[model samples]
Target: MIRIATPDDVPVIHTLIRELAEYEKALEEARATPEQLHEALFGENPAAYAHIAQDDATGEPVGFSVWFLNFSTWRGVHGIYLEDLYVRPSARGGGHGRALLTELARICVDRGYQRLEWSVLNWNRPAIGFYESLGARPQDEWTVYRLTDEALESLGKRG
Candidate 1:
């Protein structure tokens, strides 16, 4: 079962995020606190939205997706930028991942969005394979870039 996330789901969402970071071998960078997440998701002006996938029988959350909108100039429409989608290690392969993605796709289609996108670490073969199986193509022509920390501060000062 899938449903929109409520404020009560923040703790579990944070846990899933930490678990995902661990899986990606970057746990140290997963520094978001539950309060920060709550404010992000439930603040007066929400920056993102989330969905929870519940265990069918027990109704316990087993997976989740957090996403925000991104505008596409070429497509002339807004698309969902999935920040994270994760199923608990013990609960993987139970269709939770696919179910979460299907829901997002449906939202895109219903809202007339042109695309649904997310980035994957290069070494995550299992996730890449799973996404490919759902007909998701890689945008290999474009390389992702980031400016953060001291570099970001320097640029801010230069400007």
Candidate 2:
């Protein structure tokens, strides 16, 4: 079963996020605290939303997805930017990942959104194959960039 996450699920969600980071060999960069997650997901003006996937029989959460809406100026419509989608190592291969993605697609279709997108590490061949099997194509022509930490601070001060 899958359902929208509530404030109470923030801790579990954080745990799952850390687990994902570990799997990606970037656990050192996982700095999201539970409080931060709660505010980001449940604050008055939420910055993101999350969904939890549970075992139907056990009723225990086995995976989670964190996402937010992004505007496509060219398309003139909103799209979902999936920040993280993680299924517990033990619970993987149970269709939880696909189920979560299917739900996101359903949300996009229901809201008349332009697209649903996310990034996957190039080294994660298994994940890449899974996404490809789902008919998701990589945007090879576009390069992604980021500004954070000292660079972000420098830019803010320069402005």
Candidate 3:
């Protein structure tokens, strides 16, 4: 059962985020708090949205996918940028991940989004294969760039 997450799901969501970070070997950088999650997803101007997969019989959340909208200048259409997609190890191979991804793709098609994009760690071969199986290819011509906390602060002071 995949559905939009509500405020009440924060605790479980927080746990899942931490679990995912640990899986990615970045547990030390996982500083998300309940308050931060709430503000990002449910504040006056929500920045993103989340979908949770729950056990059909037990009603316990097993995984989640969170995303935000992005605009492609070339295509002139808004698309979904998937930020996080995680399934508990026990839930893997159960089709939950595929189902969640299928739903997100459906949303893109229905809404006429130009593209759906995300990044996988270079070492995560399993994820790369899964994405390839779904016909998502890596954009070899482009490199992802980011400004960390300190860099962002410095940019502001450079003026």
Error of 3 at 48 (Å): 0.2
lDDT of 2 by residue, 11-60 (tens): 89989999999999999999989999999999989999999999878989
lDDT comparing candidate 2 with the true structure: 0.95
Model 1 RMSD vs true structure? 0.8
The worst-scoring run of ten residues by lDDT in candidate 3 lies at: 91-100
TM-score quality measure for candidate 1? 0.98
> Candidate 3 on 24-89: residue-level lDDT in tens?
999999998999999999999999999999887898899999899999999999999999999999
lDDT of 1 by residue, 1-159 (tens): 889999999999999999999989999999999999999999999999999999998999999999999999999999999999999877889999999999999999999998999999999999999999999999999999999889999999994
| CA RMSD (A), model 2 | 0.8
lDDT of 3 at 61: 97
Worst 10 residues of 1 by lDDT: 87-96
Model 1 stretches astray by more than 4 angstroms: none
Q: 1 or 3, which is superior by lDDT?
A: 1
Which stretches of model 2 miss by more than 4 angstroms?
none
